[model samples]
Target: MEEKKIVSIEDRIPKLKEARKKKANRRLLFYLSIFFLLIAAIIYLQSPLSNIKHIEVTGNKIISDEEIIQLSGLSPETNIWVINHKQLKQSIEKNPLIKEIKVKRKLPQSVQIQISEHKIVGYVKSELEYHPVLESGMIINKHNISNKGDGPLLINFDDEEYLKRMAKELGEIPDHIFNLISEISWEPTEKNKYKVVLYMNDGFIVHATLRNFASKMKTYPSIIAQLDEGEKGIVHMGVGTYFEKLEK
Candidate 1:
């Protein structure tokens, strides 16, 4: 500056007051905003908007959605924020069919539950009604004749111990090979109590034992591949793998 200009107190006072006024207004607006936000949050939490309005269940086949939801202990009135996901999952898993469950909360008031059921590897006929045999070697009660499952049918399997063993063995078989099996009949003798006869979908009869059945049957596809097309025979899979053609 070329010269020092003395500012009057009155002139500087208005500018200082204007700055303080602006700062105070900003602080007031901030406090008001915070207060309104708190009020809105409280209102939202108290309103039904915070309640679970929608519940979706998926990945359930044998267990019905209604049954799954009922097992979850969740309803429209249940609050999404207060859900105990672990407890709900444990509750649904009490059913033997239910292997696993996942519970998740979707924002704004919805919940999703996913269920995984045990796989049915085969079916055992009991009194003309076939019951599903799970991969876990457990058999469930029969529902209806029409509901007889898609897997291979087990016949003449009266002993629970052997049936469990058979179910476990069947579980290890690959789906492609398992599909080829139409029926398995238990024909135990004094010499070999684990004897089983399998009727294949390709018109081949298989004579196998429960011992090492899964390991031996894994080669069934390859065995059938080497045979002539539309060939019907008895496949001996015990000590040695061979074929005996039927007299057509």
Candidate 2:
């Protein structure tokens, strides 16, 4: 009886080893299958089949879609997953007029871009040309940047830098005050102060300087509230706030 039991134990041990080997082989095959599938997925995503097929651009009034595409160097042939977003932003920033921009990939082959442009509050004339002045008081590049409206034209000897500075502050100023401003001027004189010679559309001149523009201008809404229809003249904000006009 003991001999028979030993023979049976030997046979059972061999069967167990065979089962363990079979299980190990099955696990190895499963892992390898998953690995190959992952590689195939990666290749598909990187190929043209998953490349950028369309492009959408918005919030671009100053820049056109074609221009954005050209500036970003993005096209239908570009791969969405492989494209570098930082490179695209740097390319668009090349345009000095662009204040801010955004770029992104929209799955399965699409790219989108959004942009905001610099605001033009006023303009300055040079010899025979003009440059648009930004709200920040900086001049934007324009060969013949001219305004065609019923407002005061700035006649400044040193308008180049002022125009650039003015351009930078356009969006920061209140819209009503901006529209009320008819003209701005700068002189290359002893006090090269950025003086704002505002001419109201309603026949009044605003004596404002760019130094404390935001804080000083904040008092304007209240001042205009106290004015009468017949009241018209210069509102001096440079020093102590006051309003005056030439003897009629």
Per-residue lDDT value at 46 in model 2: 67
Q: Candidate 2 on 166-208: residue-level lDDT in tens?
A: 5444456677776766666654346746776666676777777
Runs with alpha carbons beyond 4 Å of true place in candidate 2: 1-22, 42-46, 126-130, 135-138, 142-153, 157-161, 164-171, 187-192, 245-248
**TM-score, per-candidate, Cα-based:** 0.80, 0.76
Model 2, total clashes: 23
Please identify model 1 stretches exceeding 4 Å from their true place: 1-28, 142-148, 159-161, 188-193
Cα TM-score of candidate 1: 0.80
lDDT of 2: 0.70
- Ten residues in sequence with the least summed lDDT for candidate 2: 143-152
Write model 1 residue lDDT over 33-73, tens digit each, in one string: 99999999899888889999999999877777888888889
Q: What CA RMSD would you report for each candidate?
A: 3.4, 4.6
